[model samples]
Target chain A: MIRIEDVSLRHGQTQILHDIWLTIPKGGITALVGPNGAGKSSLLSLIARLQPLQAGRISVDSFPVDTTPSRDLARILAILRQDSIVTSRLRVRELVGFGRFPHGRGRLTPDDYAIIDQSLQQFDLTDLSDRFIETLSGGQRQRALVAMAFAQGTDYLLLDEPLNNLDMFFARELMRSLRRIADENGKTIVIVLHDINQASAHADRIVAMKSGRIVADGTPSDLLTPKTLQAVFGFQMRVETFDDMPVVLHFR
Target chain B: MSIAATKQASKTGWVAGLTLAVLFVFSLCVGVDDMPIIRLFSDGRALELLLVSRLPRTLAAILTGAGLAIAGLIMQTLARNRYVEPSTAGTAQSAELGILLVTLLLPSASLLFKSLAASAAALLGTSLFLMTAHRLPPTQPFLVPLFGLVYGGVIGAAVTFVAWQADLLQYLSVWTNGDFSGVLRGRYELLWLGALMVVVAWMVADRLTIMALGRDASIGLGLDHARMLQLGLIIVSVISALSVVVVGMIPFVGLVVPNIVSRLMGDNMRGTLPTVAVSGAILVLGCDILGRLIRYPYEIPVGTVMGCVGGLIFLWLLFRRPSHV
Candidate 1:
């Protein structure tokens, strides 16, 4: 379990997240949904220790996040942010090979290569493994990045809006892939998602936030109601159930 | 591709290694004094100059070239942009300023003292660059290097002004030339420290690589982003500052060698550092040899030859539409 207690953050004088408390249970897909400036990314950063904590405690699997050795932390958790820009011309396989860095320290043994190859196949990037990352399109590049994270072999995977800039088909495919990884591999996945329906369809649990505070947290079926949507997004939306999942119609 | 083609592609390093070795031997032979090859070892004065002076200078050039190239690779990786290097990004100028200040203040300061001052100054400049980067809105990351160039140019102009007024322009020119002539046995020992830094850099290469991805990603992976970056900057400053101290400012050696090596051998630091070292050695040695050949007895400085040739090569590398991905 990932537990956050009284986490507060201030950028200069402006408060970003205030006295936030959250708990993400193990072995499932949890989607964090919020509007812009809602501190979803900030909270993720704090949990992952990407940014230093100003005033809170975070623990991953009972170990305090702040005190754990980075290599130890890397073993348990892997994070993929929205923007991963690598300027060097690295082939897709080489990029995925970096997933083994925390474990092998850049000298990959046979086991590391096996894990890398498996990750490439899992992400359906086996065909493009030899291609350079710069040559790949947006969706392909995102897959390559996801493949790398998967290759990390961490139990807890944190993705900050992994679907940004992906087209409709690729977005659904990626969501499906994440769902499979979480279900089949039994990995605990925490993803920040913009599309409410994607969260509703794929997420086992949905945590809604606004103004840096978690207003609601429950199963997607329980949390994706029109009332909660109105409260969280400040918008009136119609909701319908398809395949036993709540789909919010906010487009019109 | 055919079997021969595949084998050829895989042997890029070997080809580069052979070329560098050949060039090194040629560089050893070519110099201001055209003593016969057999007499080089027998003649006492010639032997002393060649073995002690020329040999050290050549080794200094090789080490400086390697250190600078790796430093550039680190900086470019950290910044996540091409077209950025320590010299172009102002780190070298800041180091030079530090050296100039210490020299002016304490004329009797040892070379080590000057190097420390230069390292400190380079560190300060790099910190300023990073802090300033945080406040600005996101755009092309290349803006960092552009700003660095402008910043470096301002400091470089100031250095020139100071040198002119102090009637130390000749002294300043010597530092700017990237020459290997003055490097002797005792004076050039400082370069061994840079080789140690390269080793340290390799040990921390994993951390540096992750940090290069993005601040958030590195943090998510639980790496101390700030400390890693600070460490990288420290490495870069020490290498650039010491390179300047040893053989003036040999401009594009840093930019050209790493880019070439990264393109050829993958970007992994473990795989590429050796190639970068060899390629840097070859480039500098070739330039040094060319400098000797062009002017003969006059002995043009290695810096001028490198700048002229390296500038043209850099332009070609930048504009050649980049064949390799």
Candidate 2:
């Protein structure tokens, strides 16, 4: 479990995340959904230790995020930020191979190579593995980045807006892959998602945030109601049922 | 295809190694003294010149070239901007400042003492540049080199002012002009420190490449990003300072060689380091030879030749479409 208690972040005079208390259990997909500037990414960054915690405690499994060594945290958790810019010219396979650095320290063993190959295959990048990352399309590069995070073989994965720039098909495919990984591998996935329907159809639980506080937290069935959507996004939304799942229709 | 790629890279490495070897022989042969190939064995004076003067000069040229190239590669990787090198980033200027200070304080200081002082100053200057770079917004990549140039100009002005006041301006110019004409066995042994740094760089090549992936990605991969960056900066400083103190600042060997090698072999540091080093040596050797031949006995400084060549190449690189991922 990842436990975040009384977590608050302040940048100068503005509060980014205010007293965020949330517990994310192990071995399932939990989606964080919110409107623009809702502090969803900030909260995720705090949990991943990408940003330092100013006023609270966060722990993954049993290790404290603040004091734990980064290598130990890396083994337990891997995070992929949204605006990751790879400045070097690297092949797709080479980028994925870097995910194993925590284990191999840049010298990949045969076992590490197997894991890398598995990650490439998992992300459907086996064919493009040899290609340079700069040559890939935006969505393909995004997949490659995710594959790199996956190749770290961590038990917990924290992704901040991984669906950005992805087309509908690739987006759904990525979500499905996340769902499968969660179910089969028992990896805990905490993803910040922009699309409510994606959370509705895939995420086991949805946490809604607005103006730096958690407004709602429950299963998709309980949290995807029109009333809740309005409270979170400050706009009217229509929630309809499809295949026994609530599909939110916010667009006019 | 992967096998073929590796084979092709090795082939390129071999070709580069061969070129360096040929240049080494030519560099040993082309000098003021007529030391023919056979006379190296028969004549004592010829052998003495070859060992004490010619050989050291050639080694100094090669080591300075290769060391600065490696230093430039590390700097570019750490800065995540191709335009930042020792010359542009104020490393050379800071080193020259260190030499100036030492000459003022300890007028008769040994070469080792001078090198130590210069390396310390280089480290300080590089660290300041890195700290400033960290504060700047990442929106503009070009701003990095510009900041470096302005920063270097300030340091250069300071050194010049001090040297001019002390009436050591002529001495300072000789130091900064980067000619190996004065290199002899004892005077050039300090360059071996640079060679050791090159070995250290190779040992940590993987970490340096990881650094090029940016701070978040590297930290995400469990790398001690801050520590690795510090190590890289130190390596760059030591090599840059040593090169400046020994042969003066060989302009653009670091910037051009690494960029060219990256264009051909990609940025996997493990696979590209040897090629980068060899190419650096080759470029300096070729330029040094040209410098020797251009005026025969009088000889232009290698720094002047490289500045012209490196400036043109840098302009071409600036106008070309960026290939960074």
Candidate 3:
């Protein structure tokens, strides 16, 4: 379980996240959907300890984020931050292998390599494993990044916009991959997503945010109505059912 | 991407090691008052010269080369910029400034004192550059190195002005021009300290490689990013300062060698560090030999030759496709 209590973030003079309290239980996919500047990424970063918490308490399992040793916390929690750019000339397998660092400290055992290869296979990246990351297309690189985070072997994963740069086919494939991992491995996944329909389809729970505050939080059927969507996004959009799922017609 | 390529990279590594060995032997051979290969067994005076001058000079060249190349690799990781090395980023100039100021204050200070002063100033300068370089728009990556060039130029000009006011121009020239002709048995042992920094770097090679992934990624990977950064700063500053103190300022060995090796062997420092070290040693040794042969009787400074050779390679690095971004 990941717990966040009374979390607030301020950047310069602006309040980015205001008294945000969220508790995510172990297993399942929780999608944080919001408009721009809604503090989804900021909240995720604070929980992941990517940035120092200003006024909050966050813990993964029983370990306090503020006081926990990074290595210890990393063995349990992995994060894929938005805007993560790797400029190094690294092959895909080697890059994914970096995820095992906290465990092996760069001296990877055969077991660690198996985990890396498994991650590559999970993301359908086994063939592209030896390709340089720079040579991969943007979508392929995004999948590689996601694969690396998965290779960390952490129970709880915090991904900020992992679907960015991915085309429709890969994006849906990635969401399905997340769903498979969440179901089979019982991994606790918290994802920040932009496309509402994607969240409505794959997310077990959707937490909608607006103006640095959570406006609505519940299952997609209850929380993703047009009224809540308008309140969260400041615009009206029709939410209809397709194949027993809420397919949000957000387009004009 | 194939087993063949991996085999080929190792092949290249072996070939580079061989080339470096050949260059090391050739460097020992090309000095003035040449001792033939048989002279060591035949003549005692020639043997004494080899131990006192040739051996020390060659070792210092190799050590300084390896040290600065590793330093450059670390700096690039820490700064997250490929183009900034010690000489281009005001580190070497800051060391020169610190030495100049210390000399003006106390003309009779010990060599240790001078080196400490140089390292301190170098640390400050490098940290300042790394801090500011990130603030510039990273979209145009050339801007960081360009700012670094100007920053190094400003520090260098300040050093020159101070030296001129005190009429220490000759002293300045001796310290600024990198030449190993003055190296003797006990004189150049400070580079061994720089070599120790390399060993420490190799010990923490994985952490340094993680740093290339940037701060957030490094922290996410469970590295103590701030501590690793401090270690990297100390390593670069100490190596740059030691080289400046011992051999004046050898330009481009740091910048040129690391990039070439990275292009060939990727960024895993643990896998590529030895290659980077050997490649750097070979470049410097080869340049020193070229400086010897380019003018037979009178020797050209190694720094001057490197400025030409490294500058051309640097231009090629600048204008190349940049390895597909």
lDDT, residue B216, candidate 3: 86
Comparing 1 with 2 on TM-score, the higher-scoring candidate is 2
Rank ordering of all candidates by TM-score, starting from the highest: 3, 2, 1
DockQ of each: 0.50, 0.67, 0.73
Q: What share of the true interface contacts does candidate 1 keep?
A: 0.57
Off by over 4 Å in 2: B322-325
Q: State the lDDT at B189 in candidate 2.
A: 84
Candidate lDDT (C-alpha), each: 0.81, 0.89, 0.90
Per-residue accuracy of model 1 over A165-226 as CA lDDT, tens digit each: 78999899989989998899999999999999999989999999899898999999999888
Instruction: Summarize candidate 3's per-residue lDDT along B20-95 as a digit string, tens digits.
Output: 8888888778877878878697898889888898889899989988998988888888878888899889999999
Fraction of native contacts under 8 Å reproduced by each candidate: 0.57, 0.64, 0.79
Q: Estimate each model's TM-score.
A: 0.92, 0.98, 0.98
For candidate 1, what is the DockQ? 0.50
Candidate 2 lDDT score at position A191: 95
